[model samples]
Target: MKAVTGLGWGALILTLALAPLLAVDLILIYLLEDTPFRILSTLAMLGCFYLLSTILSLFVDALTGALRSFVHSNIPRLIDTILHGTVSGISLYVVLTLFPSIDLSTLTVMAIVFVHLFGASFWLNRENSKEDVPLELDSIDQQIIHLLRTETIVSCVERIQHDYPNLPKRDILKRVKRISQSNKVTEPFHGR
Candidate 1:
């Protein structure tokens, strides 16, 4: 899996964590049935929810990184799932406390979190595992390949990186290596 940056994970987790707050807020607005009070309550609730979600996201990101270093496997996903579940549980408890007559169940909360986490995992994994198709060398790529014949890979990578600051060094190295290997295979077949 492509490693998620702390900021990336933080944003994702914060968004997911807000789901329960939105649900509860809507429920409260409906139950209270007072427009002015609803507006004030919603504003206050949103502020609290935003603050809490930010803190929760940072905690999860730090914990995920720490666990990843220790476990050295796909433990981040497990950590994320557990953290999200805990957040969902806490949110559900708070919602129930505020409105005892609310008809939400623990299972319902779990199901929502599970579905959200599962979908995120599936999407991220799919994106991470996708392989680039063998490139049809464009003019610039061909120029780079030609340069590889006379230049060291490091030199080519440096030159490319200098010219294309947005392109990752590793990607340039991979492309050069792939092009070189393909040339070797074709040269033997073409008697060149």
Candidate 2:
């Protein structure tokens, strides 16, 4: 599996966050008689759901990335889906509580929406992963890339220990600095 780029992550998050809210809004409009209170309440509920889903998505992504090495990738993905489903379930429950006039059948519909959202999110993540190719680097080159990406010498040293225990930190730092300097050449452009 490959890491999702920052733009891909943003797009996925926005889609997962907004899609269900749009469904719920349409359902609310259809089920309720036209009234100011119903419209206001539905708008409020949409706002709350959007805010919660955005925060939850970001938190889940970070948590899954941090735990990447400890567990199988699918495990975290499954856990995130379940957690998102639970959030949807909670939102439905809250709506039901606030508006007792809504029929019990609405819960079943909401449950379907929850399941659909989970599946969609999982599918989106899978598709995004397909777009990325894992970075290929030798051990020393990996350390150098890490240093350049993170701009943290200490993290580079720690990465060396974790990935190449026998390699000395000083040697890695020296080679990374040399590579960094050598890659900084500027050339004047000529007409083709």
Q: What lDDT score belongs to each candidate, Candidate 1 first?
A: 0.59, 0.59
Query: Candidate 2, residues 1-192: lDDT per residue as tens digits?
Result: 235587788878877876775775556456543434455565565555556555665676677667864563445456666766666666556655665654345545465456546665777588568745444556677556656564554665666667777878766666666555554322223447
lDDT of 2 at 74: 48
RMSD of each: 10.8, 13.2
Reference-based TM-score of each model: 0.37, 0.44
Whole-model lDDT, model 2: 0.59
Task: Give Cα distance to truth, residue 124, candidate 2, Å.
Answer: 4.4
Model 2, residue 192: C-alpha shift (Å) = 47
Q: How well is each residue in 20-87 modelled by candidate 1, as lDDT tens digits?
A: 75666555445544334444555554455445544675677687778776775556355566675566
Clash-forming residue pairs, model 1: none
